[model samples]
Target: MTMAAMAVLPSRFIKCFSLSSASAPVSTLQEIASASPQGVAKVVLKKGKTQLFKYGSPMVYSGAVDRIIGRPPPKTGEVVLVADGAEVPIGWGLYNSVSMFCVRLMQLEEEASREPTCALNMERLLEHRINAATDLRRQLGLPSINTNAYRLVNSEGDRLSGLIVDVFGDVAVVASSAAWVEKYKQEIEAFINKVDGISHINWRPSVDILKEEGLDLLQLKHASVASPSQVEVKENGIRYAISLEGQKTGFYADQRENRQFISTIAKGKRVLDVCCYSGGFSLNAAHGGAVSVTGVDSSMPALELAEKNIVLNGLDSERITFLKQDASDFMKKAAARNETWDIVVLDPPKLAPRKEVLQNASGMYRNLNALAMRLTKKGGVLMTCSCSGAMTQSGTFMRVIQGAAAMAGRKVTILRQAGAASDHPIDPSYPEGAYLSNIMLRVL
Candidate 1:
């Protein structure tokens, strides 16, 4: 940023933002100062786009940028200051040259004033944010005797955008999506390794996402060595075999509360769990005294794990059975045979990863829900879920379910509406982080 523009900002703000004087470690201090000796690069925003970010939106899209001002242009994964049209510093963030998200704002001007030591110091900021996240989970009573698997850092929710950390037993799986996170992989690992009860760290990079952030795929692969292939964890007093290489961070800890709810309502009920990854809902249902539980999935490996979990928990295999079949196919045949269950749990994978495909995905969700509803006995309960952030953020998932009920010739009333568990906190500024819509309905 130019000295004249810097002059326009408050004196206190400037002092707190001065990288050279930041109370950071010497090595990190030198890196920040040397990276931009002429002062940090400034990302000038369009006139009308300043307020959204000023009001605490973490993502600074390329479309919002009017122009950039710096002697040597800032490279991707570098720290840069974000300024308004008149060149007033609104915040500072990690810059990306190729991605649609030009900048991921780390802290606002007010935040810097409060914690000046972290200003322009990514290392210090990471430590502070991660420690705070760890403390928050402790406050939420995570890693208790009954549950040791849960989300530790929820990307934007934890103020660490493009970074998700799920802790399972003694291992922590770090999912990196942004170029900056990749750049600071070692620093992140070092901090996470220091967390209590964590003995191993697994680095899982989002290949497609990093590619969009202008990263080299080959280098990304060698970022970290392999961690434990599998981990045994307990959730809601139930044992689970978590495969690190399975889906996103292995187990679906976000649905912990929702699964517990299933157990509560499964007593004496015949429960059918569609797209049951690793038999989470099915196991809960069985534990809750379900007369019979059927778990269906397309993944053979997932089903294998699910079956193993049934044996692990010492539950009656005859009472809870798993099937390897497509969700729609199983529901269709069950409905055709006039076979219905007392409760149906449909937790589909992300059907709409992006907003552009939401229209097409809605049809898929509707069809699945219609089939699920059809296979539900009269007055039976149906717990449906959509992990698509686009669908959940669009606020039309309920409408789609309603349309599905109309198609199935069934009347549905919502018994409950929920999102991810408490551990997966959502930042109001970034509602996109709010995925996993779990709605319970009474089908008639």
Candidate 2:
């Protein structure tokens, strides 16, 4: 499909746009022309006998008729077809003149749009998504364990693109990276209020993506209410005190099942949780009866939270050590000190968000995994992961880890391959939704 054809609009609106062809039933090329005072005629579209000027003259669509007859095409602003006859604006979206996907639909139907402004519908969708996620968790029998933390809404996975809500205990951190969601701030806040068992709501907008979308770099418009700053949440019988204002919904819900898997094999072994934000894996290891657990992270605040979680779980604090240092640097330092761990987890943040940086990100992953392998004792477990959607193919991640192991002079045996927790379902058509890849390997 051409970029213009892929533009965001409800199927209903797009269905109304008919393409004509000379040899075909009707001419599809309505018109093509450059829109400038001195520019030549480029392209044009025809509706009945009226010839709608397109390329040469500016594209204009009447708000009253919902028809693209004559007017300058929108360059940067959003496209809104007036409700005329059978045509209606489906939802709000962004439009770009340069790219083929000139229109990016933000919502399906304006009336069905679940923004913060539409409290009733927003709450309904939130409840629907939460109930759906909860049903999957129950069907999986995860409730038999003591864990309560899980993903509530996984962006496009829930058909709510650019919105992520992770529930930790009674608190929910709503992260909106797209302007469409941000635009409905009030509706979101109101919906969050109606949810049962949720007392606090914190909003975190992915500013980086917003900037790329040509949006203003600003703080979260919705201020957080007075909620518990920290609370103990259980995961697979492992306790963790999550901070409401912490990164990516406090704990990494994507790796919940993977952490449990690592714990099952952590009995009586020294485990290192590198880049252990809030000590998800470290606590799991200790709960699984690991001999020792050392959690390393550069964020002091996160380390502090991890410490609280360790105490909350009634685990031996002496057995769990928190280190404030860069994960890669800590691994190198541990190697220098001859410190070895029977199991090591290298769950780093996304190194590459775009495909252009795949090579550089792969190199970084290779270097980190190499260090992780070096820190692992012979025949030890190495649980490494890549949450970058850009590294979509499993082969790409496997090759990088294999290369890293070879550099560390260790042959690796794949024990188990994992992915995002069940709540974060992957659509068959959208492979990008399945971004998290967890591989548990035994270094030989």
Candidate 3:
């Protein structure tokens, strides 16, 4: 079922679970015997909590759960029916005992009734959701001649929480964070294999996250042995060498549109790309006829790949160069030397992985932006980004930038505010799925 109608299901069935809520009480177990599936567990939500799930919030946190109904309680990764306070089945999802997210709802009651083939079926549901994601990408013209590297499944954005799939050429890199995904690894791989242009399935499990999901770290295996360590791919007509062993899903396909945007305004400009992993923006600036481009990152491997990309596209190496240095150190020194760039791009790693570190991360972001602002020429553009979900979802990134501008003693006017590319869709209900905040500001 499509994600738009994913949570539109209304409960009309009688109460089935043994538990009862004060708002809607159940008379007898026989009242809804026909609707309840035999031998299946039910996760009943607290009163007033059903609306959020009904409105398409995929994650059913443990705090929202009233009580669980089952003979033997459902284990983590097991499919369980999610019911309202009245015990009426609203949908079904994978249950996680250890994680804060008690349930990851897959299909709503209406969706289950419409597509009975995948109703209450994890394997079939996976196939249906993956197909839906593929169709969405096809409609968006992904994996086109100019761009073969892109996101296939964007976790909750694609209605499959704790799962992400990125396609780089013939390989489908699946990153698993949920116990259900890990449990159905083979099934997931099989479905991915059926997709076009997917010859290999690379499994990349978020080990630490899986641990929180109650998965055994010792038993987990990462990166398919059959999958190549490195694969070259084309994005926006530029070639890139992606390292499978490297960062999240090998490459940052989310910044596809943002990087392409950098190319458009880079003509004859001196562009500086900080945390320039694999030189996405730097190469784009060079390709866009920039007079000079400098990419700085702490990772040597990334800089090496960036250097190779310049050669891969047969671009003028003399015009584009990469340096391995801490971003803040490089920017501070450049500012001290009175160095300035016509365009400065800052795409940092996740500084605030959790909400607890958001305040500290805000300071880091402010300082980084301040330094980058100091290095920007008057009336120049600065494209800064934060992949921290806490920062983006909290709606404080703009304020942080404003504070940074004040600290830099530079006035800034907003040019454009963007997020992940078109292929990386966001489900409005799950704002957490919306990470990557790319903002364009003119420094004066």
Candidate 4:
């Protein structure tokens, strides 16, 4: 059969079995029964469609398919079908019965094939995605530090969909956000070990997102956690002890470069690190010869950990002080008290998780930076950061900071523009991968 004929026949048959004409939802069994052997056979003849067998065809019906089609049987797969206007094969995806993401496409075929295997090739896919990430890190000249605490794989950026793995020295933190990836955790752990120099692996399942996916959340399953009690990792030559049980994978690896940048200009200066989780920047500044450093955070546990890290670095405990207070509130109070600082660091958590909240999040960023600027001495450095991906675009975040500086009657000069560490490589195709945006401004 012709290629066009091959594509159309199976698609039509799969559509027939996969969906109902009356617009009613279809069950898995009904979807399978509706599949025509002829349509399946025709599509099987077409080349470059070998991987379809791993994931069942739309005609075969699966739990995922049933979830997409809310009601039982007779609904048309055409509801979520994406057709190539010209003679391209029809693409098949799972339809959501109740969620906003109504469809999740799985395959594109010229004709329906009854190979009974339409799932993705798990082993091959994993190898390809992992290697791609590894190659990118190497290309960027990373992996040289004594510490291996860097992101090894970043979910959709690596094309793995819902898997994120971070390497901290000899430990690997494997966090999964998808059911498919969770099912293959063992294989992923094995791959990390095979990469050499990796000692242990910790699994952190996506409890929040997994709950949304209607799956049971799992805990941190590790073989053994014994690489080091106070693992010393260097960021711009300043040492830090990373605790695994702490925040996202134990450390904010993304601020590695930015913290180092802060150290360069901190000599003989008094610095304030707002929202300093575990004092990542505070310690870096103190080590860089800052006369005194103050860290403000709301979490008492995090502040305690920050103090421990300060002691771990052999710095004078008196040089670094921690305050348990909200970052914005503290900044405002410092401004009211006229407590000026030679350098100020504002690194806040992600305020906007989605695009819809971008406006409110931008206003928050503006107000926070404005307060920070008001407390900064003339010619002093103000290093502000936004981890929220929604705020990192070219003009979006810069404008927010600019508005704050203008309102504070300060002329802000950009000394350096920084982003996440080398390990979190950004794909050219995915600009969103550049989530952490740090700007060093001198408020004159």
Off by over 4 Å in 1: 1-38, 223-226
Q: Which candidate would rank higher by TM-score, 3 or 4?
A: 3
True lDDT of residue 267, candidate 4? 95
User: Which of the numbered candidates is closest to the native, going by highest lDDT?
Assistant: 1
Encode model 3's per-residue lDDT on 1-444: one tens digit a residue: 454553464443223221343356332222333455666788999999999998999999999999999889999998888988878888889999999999999988877667777777788889999999999999999889999999999999999999999999999998999999989998888999999989988899999999999988976965437779999999999999999999999999999999999999999899999999999999999989899999999999998899889899999888998999999999999999999999999999999999999999999999999999999999999999999999999999999999999999999999999999988888999888988999999999
Candidate 3's C-alpha runs over 4 A off are 1-38, 222-224
Query: Global lDDT for candidate 4?
Result: 0.68
Instruction: Assess every candidate by TM-score.
Output: 0.92, 0.72, 0.92, 0.72
Q: lDDT tens string, model 4, 246-277?
A: 77777887888788777888899999999998
lDDT tens readout by residue for model 2, 1-444: 575765876776666554432233211111111222332211111232112111111122222122342345543433322211322222333443333323333333323333433222344554565566556656766444576787767776765666788878777788886655676667666765665567778777888776655566654445646768677777887777777667766678888888888778889999999988888899889988999999999999999888888788888988999999998888888899988889999899989888899999999999999999999899888999888988855459988988998899899999888889888876554465778888889898
Q: Which stretches of candidate 2 lie over 4 Å from their true place?
A: 1-145, 217-220, 393-395
Q: Quick one: how many clashes does candidate 2 have?
A: 37
- Candidate 4 wrong stretches, greater than 4 Å: 1-120, 138-142, 216-232, 393-395
- What is candidate 1's TM-score against the reference? 0.92
What local lDDT does model 3 show for residue 411? 99
Clashing pairs in 3: none
Residue pairs in clash, model 1 = none
